[model samples]
Target: MVENPLETETLARLYLAQGHPEKALPIFEKLLSREPDRLSIRESLARCRDEVSRAGREAAVNEKKRLRILERMLARLTGSTPPEEEIPAAPAIQPPRPGAVERRLAVLKQMLQRLERSR
Candidate 1:
């Protein structure tokens, strides 16, 4: 059965709204391929691609942050300091609270020590 273009476009938009651009990407691509002159479809395709790219960059940044946190925790456990270059600088717009890093490190160290004792 032939699918209605309007229905397909609506489905694609729903996927985009639900934060699943990956799913919407193919649908938009299909719509655009069938209706290359349709400006709305073309715009939706561009938006979907941009969303996918943005999500990828965000995931990479989050992964880096998680790795840095883990490295810091490991360094604390081993009584060694992580290299200065490995530490990320605080965002300029929102300065970190004084002693915040130290407090967090201390709490992490206590938790690690307790975990070691439990083992």
Candidate 2:
């Protein structure tokens, strides 16, 4: 039976070499906290953190693109308006007041009487 190796530094380096930087991140971070003077470990931790951030940004962009594609496909399947066809928000309009409505009716009646007199 082979005993499993449990060296934290070795395991961290192994994770880095295996392109699993995210997995190595916390290990290096803890190791750095313990050995703050270790420049190599600090650099490794920084690199891992940068890689993780870049990956997160790339994933977010990919998710946005995937959602856009899915939205277009759903619009096509359901015969709904596409994103590009989305209408601008309508402007707010106040309802006509009773006095304003009555004023307009009176003006229209005056115009009608003038039209009849002209005829």
Candidate 3:
């Protein structure tokens, strides 16, 4: 039955003050959506998002670096190739006829000239 918006804002602020930023974020965002011009509420919400994103990004970077360093150290200590997918050997190639390669090259050059003239 509270008629005052400030009272609701105060309660949301209390939640934030208690280190329950996640709990407070939705309330603040809802109120801000109802009154989008409230700069103070918008700023608080932005701060919360920025902190969360920075923490997430830093954790991702640390994890990536840890894996990279471990891979390098493992390669160095073993002095052996790390487990890798085997590349299937290509089938042996027969030498092409002299005119065959020349014809392909000529066709490619003609295509290039046509592309250049179009541009």
- TM-score of every prediction relative to native: 0.64, 0.62, 0.41
Local error of candidate 1 at 34, Å?
1.1
Best by TM-score: 1
- Angstrom error of the Cα, residue 26, model 3: value is 2.9
1-119: candidate 2 lDDT, tens digit per residue: 44334638889889988988888988897788779999999888888898889889999989978888899999999999878744569999999986999999999999999999999
**Which candidate order results from sorting by lDDT in descending order?**
1, 2, 3
Please list all clashing residue pairs in model 3, or write none if there are none.
none
Instruction: Write model 1 residue lDDT over 25-108, tens digit each, in one string.
Output: 998988888899999999999999999999999999999888888888899899998745555677779667999999999999
- Candidate 2, superposed: residue stretches over 4 Å from native: 1-7, 85-119
The sequence of per-residue lDDT tens digits that candidate 3 reaches over residues 38-88 is: 999898888766656776798898997778678778987989665454366
Candidate 1: where are CA atoms >4 Å away? 1-7, 85-119
Q: Provide the global lDDT of candidate 1 against the true structure.
A: 0.90
Cα error of candidate 3 at position 104, Å: 68
- Winning candidate number (lDDT): 1
Give the worst 10-residue stretch by lDDT in candidate 2.
1-10
Q: What is the lDDT of residue 76 in candidate 1?
A: 86
RMSD of each: 15.7, 16.9, 12.9
